[model samples]
Target chain A: MSINKIQEITSKNNARLTWEGCSILLDINDGERMVFERLTAGATLKVGNKKCSLQPLINCPFGSLFQVENGTDGPFLSRIFSTSEGSNDLQEEKESPTVYGSKDNRELMDNNTAQSLTGEDIDELRRKGASGVEIIEALITNSATFEKKTSFSQEKYRLKKQKKYSPRVLLRRPTARSICEAYFKKRPEQIGFLRMDALALLLSMASVTSHSDVLVVDMVGGLLTGAVAERLGGNGYVCNTYRGITPYPIDIVRMFNFGTEICERIVNSSLTELCATSNVTSVSSSQLEEACGTRSQSNEEGPSSSVPSLDMGEIMISSEDGDTDISPASLAVKPCKATKVGQKAPLDAIKSWRENGFSSLIIAAPQIDAWSMVKELLPLLSFSAPFAVYHQYQQPLALCMHNLQVGKMAIGLQISEPWLREYQVLPSRTHPHMQMSTSGGYILSGTRIFGSK
Target chain B: MLSMELENKVSFKRCIREGDLVIVYERHDNMKAVKVCENGVLQNRFGVFKHSDWIGKPFGSKVFSNKGGFIYLLAPTAELWTLVLSHRTQILYVADISFVIMYLEIIPGCLVLESGTGSGSLTTSLARAVAPTGHVYTFDFHDQRASSAREDFEKTGLSSLVTVGVRDIQGEGFPDEFIGQADSVFLDLPQPWLAIPSAGKMLKEDGVLCSFSPCIEQVQRSCETLKSCFTDIRTFEILLRSYEVRGERLESWENHAGGSLGSRKRRQRSTDGSNGVEASVSATIVARPSSEGRGHTGYLTFARLRCVI
Candidate 1:
């Protein structure tokens, strides 16, 4: 975890240090597909013959294309641009024939043996200060098949060559969406299958303002937790609860590198702790009064503590010790050598939780039944507080919607998935991208309300 | 009304204070922003509400009027403000506002320039996004609209972070001082192409720009202008559909307690894809999509300003 923190320090929105260990989105096959790749110095980072590395960077290497440091002798290095907009539009580069036809033009095609440039020859060309465009130009000039191709085919051929020859890597800044995208691409299982689009919908439906006090149970580790915390702008608490001996997924949380205050907003409690302490809805008014009575007494004894809510720091620590993954450095647990903190933490959490009831409940628990999970949390929110639940399949979310209807617990329950389509709008060829991923999980949204309470 | 941020922070000052922007919630759909004053009185359908009575009450507290009617005085956030603010022109809703804020990457400490701050709905979100640090310079061609938006900003306590300017951005352009200074720019005018070059000039290298237009032709023309100075240009439309969900008493409903005609109509409505789970139990769930919903707002065309290498 500490090693990851150091990596994060060097890898943050920093444009100057996009060297080894930098995360990037590799545009492969002329932007047909995107592969999320992390850069490693002196290592072969190939996106179709475009090998890259970090070596002897005396100057900033942004706004430049990738190339070999010493051609065949050494590693890759980014060279300065000869001119701004180094690779001009392919169409304007050279005047070509008419557009390509659907069928292969066998009659017009020329069959001939061309001068084939070997690997060493290409390396020598690169070593002799030949640009990617110049090398492609030389190859096209020496090709016997170049004359028979149509204009459209020529553009396609040039783009293909550019992808293979052009050594360019985009150093993208890490945003919440980008990190989420990388997670979806690389480590999707850790995120409860909640895609970025569905998560977007859930956040909006929950009305997650910066001022909101949110109760979150992120089965997807801290992906949802981090997102909600970021949205809150460190203004409110993200009271996080998980079942069993679940370890907080700090790896994903470290990507954002939020400070101690933001991390402090993320208070944790086990289900054993929560279910044992309080179920305010099931309790009668007299019991509520008794609980309030004790809460006042506790507040008097622990001034500035607000009863158990503000006193569970010790409880959360011992409860977290069940997992070996908890970093000792991150948790400064005051040497309280007792396991009794778990029981008090939840009581304190609920006591503090009911004080300024949560404005929203955001859940991404595909592992649990959505209705049961939502039903248990609904009573904790203020009347008319909104909630959005995420499920990979619609069945569970739909069940929760039904339960909301039966109990009259919420209104305006909507289930939706954002329909996103990427379009390629070139001057000549304009249409939607050929390949697209449709499902971004399912989101069920509603507002909590009471009837004559 | 007090800003949600302020209300969330200053717990000691809980009551409705003078000059506070308060969201007076009369119903789910009917809500309005009322400026709280020491002795001001507001006459509504419920009764004449005295600001004096509401002065010492906490936010989210219910207060009574002279006629024994009551209303909720809640803190105002962008979402609530958007719903309650009077519309001078076609305004973006919460869905599109959230999408733009996220996609444009409007973090705190970023400089954003927007054109024709119509109704200031999106502008408010942008201000909130870049709050306590970043500043938003908004330009509107219409003088009255610009002044009105400026007044609204002042009333909402966002004047410090937002500066409203009266300028024809499409015809003239954004002020010269902001050229190459803004981190991102937004266009909500009819002919955004006329302003794209100016928007490009206002943006820093690799900065993002978004143009909201209802028609596809506008998006096409704006894309043409955007191509010269932009990369990765894309368009999107965001829609939010809400459902009304409620629990039903299965046994009580089956007994025809509401009479034949009413129950029959309810059953007809329920059978129309309401209850997917067919279970003979004590209670069942029912959800119907809201009949009143926004259909189409505008297409948000976002593009990144190409590096000026």
Candidate 2:
């Protein structure tokens, strides 16, 4: 907004302001030290072929723009004011304005007057020490004014109008608070009161406090069962079985490959159970297979699949193996997959759960068959504590009743103590597969492997 | 409806009406007890006295609890509202607020405009920063949300610094007068690009602007609009993970072993294992009690205003 400097005001009343092809007429008393103030409003005035508006005419002892227009015979002065309004006004008046010549002088200057200067011409004058008002007068006097064109055109005016409300800053990413709030509002009852563990885990993930590495483990029911325990220990770890589907570590790597099928697969599988349930009918086996295949491919090809794997047999082996110093290479193994109904997949799922660092599990299925299957798989995995299970159907479901470390724990079945009542073996009609023992614990009726026997 | 000067005092009174759920620290018996009522006496095993005696007194003044105990009635600050507000959702924390304010380079006496007034936590901070001469106009599409935010603002006495309105910024552009009048604009809503054109219409030339998004895809969309409307667009993520500092066992736990802090420790250990060694040496086993750590939140993006032409 600061234009070029005014060299000198030779005569106050008849001073000629010149720069580039523009000039201004300052009508002031000769020999009088006059303070020319910058025009705040209505500074754009026309006197003849030449037009002028207020400019921040620097180096003139004061910051003022005296608009002057050139006529056929002489220079004509426009609206004038004394300086002293404020520095901010001098800044505001810099906005581009239209300059016109007075109507009376229009016909007389048709042959003598010069064409009015454009904004570009004024900019050049401004760069060359001519004040905005001075530049306007110079352009008018030098060029013939057959109908001087104003500095402001309809297009320029429209552009200025369009530019009024542009934001200075654009928020590039959504805040964690905003996303969490949206999620919570939509599914409050389902999520319940966010447990301190969950809040702490979220806070850690939010990275609001300090920096630390986190190892999240996924369990059976997709619940973050160990998040609280991990949070309580002041270690950063979150356990949610649901996160296993779209491995966060993998997602972090391929985040930039846009339009690729990998990205599409990630987006399609990003939702939680609600989305899963809604789209369940639409999900074909081929899609599920493809998802599983992609996970396998990533595990084989990506560097992030270094997460440890747990084996059931290694856990059930004698105490000697527990004491043995296992090498890191011996411990490494392929990631586990869910067992198909008929296929005899390795009992590695439970092993993987243990290796991943989860101490508990929650089961949502109501079938006793599933519970038996889980019981059959536990001994095959290496874990210190009895994996806790919560039955979703029961009001205030029983959790963490058995003390596996202290008692005669069953490896496979061994008709050992059953934690839940009404326990029965699946594919059986003859007798209760499980019966109550005199000590309040129930015993299994079927034969199962006993790792410790 | 009160002016900003009077709003703070009234907000304190409203906090009292709201059960003074936010605790004020007062010393009594070398311990602190909550001041429950403005008029009723605070009685404890130590002594009892009325809170009205401290009404006109300046904040941070000492008052007597009924139990003959002395308590400090520290005035409620913005931090208190952040902790005590009945959050219908996760509220923006101090960390994000600090970063957003600093990165945006918000100045005093500048007009700031924001949309999607979520919980008003950030709004309160913005209002406080640009007080006296500055103004903040916040918009939210949901009436209920706006009302809740208004209540909080009124209680906090920051309502005067801000103007709260319930309207969809995407559907209706900013008012004509406000166009090119704002010094800055912040969009915290989903699909913020929908309002970019509107933002362009309201900001002064070369003003500052910023946005908050969670996913990279969202960032990509926002960046496209930002590059078109403004210059100097940039994006980044802030990660905060805490360490466990307890007595001589000052070390981070192994649970948070995947973050930047973990890498730093690993680098240190690789250089000097003797310095890193402590109680346990098992490679995979977490040797020490892991200190709690913070992890992922979201991404942040920033941009600066430029001449459209």
Candidate 3:
């Protein structure tokens, strides 16, 4: 009970501090490895070969940086103050004009004998209580080519050595931006290769805002559901509708630091349930009853087996994402106090949706046919309500747009693929990133119209 | 233009009443905002459209002009408004605006600040993100621009969620009253570096800031200034590539090749008769990016306030 209360107090959408039992994103060594964890007394993070308890991270601000240090017990994480920020070296160098030395890399050899220090000597220094920074300094001092290298190569050498010896873990808030980027970079398949820009465009095109009734078909592992819920901010209802009896899993919504208020707003309902009151003639009553029966049976088994134990202390760091994995499942089980987010939508809410229709609709179900899904779901939106549908392939959306145009069911129809290019802005060295995602995906956006019916 | 209440939302029961703002959409690229009045009428290329004909009609209804030409009257949304708003200055489009909102992490309860509220394009979306419980404070140097933005907010029914002030944010910085209270800040000025320090002061720990510049040099200077009190500085350029779709009928090479002219004529005649003949016709849907699009908008540089106690 005490842990639950602590989580509630610190789980605000904009909370700055990391509380016990709270979810966090650990960025190790400038995104060399990213991990999501729940702060508990027994939780641990693996940096290099050593594992350290995360108890020291509780009650700290989100942007604090921690460096691994050798303590009496073993390797532990210690907070590095602002005075020793590693980025300061780069910042200071940029202040002065960078003048290339007369020396060139033509004389540099590819042989592996650049340093005189042996592995045994480094281990001896570690055993004698030398910190990671001190070890890096010692390695730099012993390198035979340290003085002969240009300033640029010298900085690169130091950066590479620092990553190996002293990796820093930056505490970051698990917002939609950071979470989407992590999933896209590490595991694009889980989220359907839905890039961050595409997700943002979908939310904007759908006009998701506070107090608006938004209908969504999120097949991309609940990333769409969670992004919509974050924008709803606990005011509007984000009703995730699906086909058949069983609802899709929304495991990613748990990554957001949403309090119970927002969690309650995220509900799910089957298409039959939503359309039952709308007098949809496609589904017969006998079939609807069978669907309901299956739903009730699944409901009985849902909480017992599907709901992972929210015990914070039992959480573990996922090692599969060796370099960048904000393991979604680990954070999904973090919010022990949250009333399950994807509960069955209440009957009264469904009744209102059938009567008034949803204010907006956003569909990201890549597995289903876009035109057929829109045909059944567009009528569920209020007249003049906007909608955005996302798909990895452009053909389905093109066909969907053409069909909608021919049917006169929507206006302002446009299929747009968002292109994002990131730039590395620096003094006299600003240019776009050499590599970027070619396609975030295509989105077909339009406003639903009032049919003659 | 927004649903301040449940009843205000577009629905079967909600219809166009007097004193409402509606977007008269003639085509995908043609739209204009008009306020509904009892005696108002709009004259355009389509024809003369009487406001009386639109009254009591549900939004998204296709209303006819006196000449039998018609146009759709849709309830205004932030995205639609961006396309139709008069450009008092170079405005932010959907691609840049959407990315900024997501990166800033704006929610319903977050307080946001912006400078040089040009045409109130992004401000409209910002107000939408921080509605029901939050607010957006926008400042511009030009008094007329600021007042025009105020009028636009009022017309859009977002006055309660936004405030437009006439202040030079670059020269004067944000007001002291907002010191350490803002959840996010945005800058779109010629010299954003001058306002970077004030944006840092106005943010809570871990709050985010964004600066939009049209040139790489400006981005270089802004990033340099941001390094003093911000972390995780990143710059991105987001553009939308719109695709046009159409169904094209192509003559199948295998069907048309090595066939006499009479056979080709016979095939054309039977194209609509059977599924096999239709398959030979190859009526396929194709999509391609539009020939011309916005090549560049600006560089968006985002940073987070350093969490130092």
Candidate 2 lDDT score at position A365: 30
RMSD of each: 11.5, 31.7, 6.0
**Model 3, runs deviating above 4 Å:** A1-11, A83-103, A107-110, A279-339, B253-282
Chain A TM-score vs. truth, each candidate: 0.65, 0.21, 0.85
Compute each candidate's TM-score over C-alphas. 0.72, 0.33, 0.89
Candidate 2, residues A1-453: lDDT per residue as tens digits?
A: 000111121111111121221112222211011111223333332222333433333122111233333334333333333322222121122231212233343333222223455558755664565543455356545555423433322222222211111101111111122212222322222223222123322322222110111222222112222222211222212222223344322211111111121111111121222123222346554654555455445444322333322221112222221212111111111232211111111122222332322222222232333344344333322221123232222211211111121122321111111121111111111111222212211111111112221
Deviation in Å, model 2, residue A295 alpha carbon:
71
Per-residue lDDT tens digits for candidate 3, residues B153-250, read: 99999998898889989999999988887889999999999999999999988899999999988999998899889988889999999987765655
Worst lDDT run of 10 residues, candidate 2 chain A, spans A1-10
Error of 1 at B161 (Å): 2.5
**Per-residue alpha-carbon lDDT of candidate 3 for residues A1-453, written as tens digits (9 for 90 to 100):** 122222233228878888887878887766656677767888898766688999889999898888888776777988876633345444333323333343455644433477788989998988888888899899889988788776665675666666667777788898888888877866677788999999999999999998888999998878899899998878779998887666777767777788889989998878877777574345565765565566656554443234432232323445341322222222223433434778777656766787788999999987888999998889888899999999999999987887776667888888999999987776655667756789899999999888723
Model 2 lDDT tens row, B221-304: 776677565654555454332211111233557655556644543322211224333412322211112244334455566665
Model 1 Cα lDDT, one tens digit per residue, B22-93: 878776577888988988998999999989887866565677888899777766656677888879999888
Flag the better candidate by TM-score, 2 or 3. Answer: 3
For residue A217, give model 3's deviation from the true position in Å: 1.0
Give chain B TM-scores in order: 0.88, 0.68, 0.91
Task: Return the clash pairs for model 3, or none.
Answer: none
lDDT of 1 by residue, A118-172 (tens): 6688888887867677888887887776766775445555554654566444434
Rate residue A97 of model 3 by lDDT.
36
- Model 3: CAPRI class: acceptable
